[model samples]
Target: MRGGAELSRHTTTVIAGGGVSGLSLAAHLAVADHRHPVVVVDDGSHPLDDRTWASWSDRPGLLDAAASRWFERIRVHVNGRTTVIPLGRYRYRVVRGSDLRSVVRRYTDPLPHFTFHRGHVDRADQDGVVVDGDHVRARWVFDSVIGPEVPPPSEAQLGFRGWYVRSERAAFDAETPTFFDFRTSQDHGASFVYVLPFDAHHALVEHTSFTASGALEIPRVQQEALTEYLTEVVCTGGHEVEREEHAVLPLHAAQAQRRRGNVLTIGTRGGLLKASTGFGYQRIQRDSEAIAKSLRRNGHPFDLPEPSGRFRMFDAVLLDVVTRESAQLERAFGALFRYRTAEPALRFLDEATTPPQEWKLFAGMPAPVYLAAAGRRLSS
Candidate 1:
């Protein structure tokens, strides 16, 4: 809604795109002792509560109150074998989008320093953001809207379709979540099915694929694949799909860095999602905390720390293998879950391992495949 009579406004900070990243930043800023005037702008374009975010963490934080479920163990299926890996200190947690959004709103809505604007942003820079033909001026801009575009060369897409289903019989391992099951057809790419059971008869069965260069499939195609997966490997017939959810994540894409002047980026726009695996909740949390700390200490949000360099290199190597040579992935991942050395591998993925621990875990990996991938990465 724009009017011709000098449509101009101002705030201490302008946050564009009210998705997970934008809302999370606002929540943190609203809680600080010395609060700044913040305005959150959104287009109301995409449905917010359409996906579930899952991550593995050793300890709960501020976001744990919204958790839908958690598991202490994971079962990985590969090459007609099931390997049960225990999460000794870590717990695999699932949080629904609707619950997360509600949590953020509850904390930020009552704060007098925060305001939410419903408008699509037209442009954003170090100066401010433009929404619906009106320029919103700000001293600093924390933008989570403009992100790196997916490149054409082997642009990997992590596509998933999940269904919350109920079975007529008791037919699920409720205590454990199936992290990955490679029994499905891999014609599209390295495909698998993941099951997160709510109880003996209710579960969220998801069919996922990792491929290079392709848009997400239509709803019918995704449904057929999920149904086929359920009948064959997961459970028997006589199960009804209660609800469906789908999402697509780009892998090995470029990252956004803090820009010059008074602009900073956060969340997916700032490369919070891990390239090898589509996990970003914890990263976004850590980033938001850092931003809040920066704002509290220096009265600005641009002086935040970057992710570890070693972890970035490791991720790049794994992404190269996944995009260039995917046939060896099932074996590669299966080796990581072996009973003898699963703990260090999990720690490595969490980016919490020491150099010695990382090397020990790397020793257990498919050395030849990763070595080749590493060489290619270095040369490139």
Candidate 2:
């Protein structure tokens, strides 16, 4: 019985790069209908393991069945002291990528219109995507593959490593996520320690930066930084590493253009990445929803508007301000949070998600250097 179904031929809407964006789009497509065929190709046979994705939101309506480790409070450390910000209305949530993949896969697999192909994509073009020397044609393609050396807005390359670990002796309040622990010296281009505790005994610790250029031993460096922070700063010892996740996201303003002519690019490859923070999950989710709505209305895939010039200009200004005055990050962030609601700040960081009052407040923050940088960007 299984053999007969497996041998059946089905037309598919091909999606390349089965990461969060790809999988989410597939799930949306699956939920939308069973008439149109949807196919996803990924290099990994198994779902991504040992990785945690953190996002700040009041509700968990973005992705269904996502693992939501909620924290009503956050701590920001600077100048050798920690300031706890009680976010009664906001909750910081994290979802493991593996969990997201598994849930999406389970939901999409049952649909006869949905299919997943495990292979490496050698090239993608207007015709279709070529996977491992095999050509598969589709009416339309959605691509998320991003290559290195893409033109970046800035010259700096920021990178970091994160790990999930469990400790027995350490005292951990799982109710709160340490948003920023800036106890480390900012001399090395703004370094900080961040943690998200799922339970009293387990947490994901990460060492991140605002400026990390050129080639780096990402795993080794992240491991060392995490261990050092855990042992020396947090005073937590006897911790066993459960898993490790590492990534090098360009903090600089990098422009990733749409390639595959018939293929409409979604997610990071479509330049949905936030120019300042490198956070793409929420933006990509929103982008996917918009694309899905368009497809549903038009009855076919189409190119997205390439992200508005106004949004890009705003992002470029913010990126210029941050990179030029890396030292003022703490003060700038403090002012933003202290003066405005978390919701407005989150929206502003994601681009123009703020009212006029919130925008004025954000603009009023103290950063003469950043203001100068912004002016330069505006002039340019």
Candidate 3:
């Protein structure tokens, strides 16, 4: 009923933006230490069904219950030819946003200190956050809403259009998902389609693009590509689009920003999205776990380690090629999965590879492109 100055409402932690990162952080605190008073403020944006997170994990971790599908191996396509990549330790997994929220509630809803508020975070500072008209002071404010203003001018926008569909006939392999199928048109950029099948009759078919010029693909244009892919390649029988999703994310190797003295960012705002791959679900979970551990171990979440410089360099170089050399993407991307074991490439992409592993992987790549990219990127 009053502003934060009037009532002086307070919590140990205030989370701004309850997307993947914020909720993941909340889940960590709720599960590990229930005594921490945490409030999550989320503006109701995308519906739960329209949201899904797909990533890979080599070992067990939190949100396992939230996962609806797991793939032991995945397929990749280059010019209509397919290669099934074997993931020795890693398993590709999908978590529906609704399921993740429900599972998190199983832990957080019972905790007296945990509060889920539906509101917009208007401002955040060293003292606390302003949501709507209320001010909630907190010792730590985790933000996912605001960050570097798409700066570095951003190299590209990774666009996605996904259709959650049900086919009249068997149309997919339930156990394996197509990680990347390049049979789709690449006119827009380095585009591909991936099919994550829940069963033989239902799947989430998505078209993804790396628009090198940072231009967004119109819905009608992307929709036509999806229609062609579905009609000619994916489906044998008519399918119903039960739901749909569209999104555009920036691609840039931007540094994390500290907005306020006590406020730290999470998710994209925190630079968790790898500029090269546009994948952050796994990184977000890891970051959330680290932040939670830091709070318990050091009484502050800022005790987290900085990201590796080598990984930043790798992302820069990869981002350059993905955007600057979009036409040659097949050779650059397909090489990782073709005629080689995928474990090393997977580890490299995850930034978990050792120097030796990196060298071995690099030895097979076109050195000139990478070297030139490194020179330009490292110099800049």
Highest TM-score: give the candidate number. 3
Tens digit of per-residue lDDT, candidate 2, span 24-81 = 8887776666367777878885466755677765545547577657666787776566
**Cα-based lDDT for every prediction:** 0.74, 0.67, 0.80
Cα lDDT, model 2, residue 329: 67
Candidate 3 per-residue C-alpha lDDT over 147-174 given as tens digits, one digit per residue, 9 for 90 to 100 = 5433455656789899988888897888
| Tens digits of per-residue lDDT for model 1, 170-236 | 8789898898888776655677789998898988999877766565555665677788877877665
List pairs with backbone clashes in candidate 2. Answer: 153-253
**Lowest-scoring 10 consecutive residues by lDDT in candidate 2?**
1-10
Best to worst by TM-score, what's the order?
A: 3, 1, 2
Q: lDDT-based ranking, best first?
A: 3, 1, 2
Q: Candidate 3: lDDT over CA atoms?
A: 0.80
Task: Assess the local accuracy of residue 323 in candidate 2 as a C-alpha lDDT between 0 and 100.
Answer: 53
- Using TM-score as the measure, name the better of candidate 1 and candidate 2: 1
What are the runs in model 2 whose C-alpha is more than 4 Å off? Answer: 1-9, 45-47, 59-62, 79-81, 146-155, 212-225, 252-255, 303-311, 339-341, 358-360
After superposition, candidate 3 runs with Cα above 4 Å error:
1-7, 148-153, 339-341
**TM-score of each model, paired residue for residue:** 0.88, 0.85, 0.92
Error of 1 at 283 (Å): 0.8
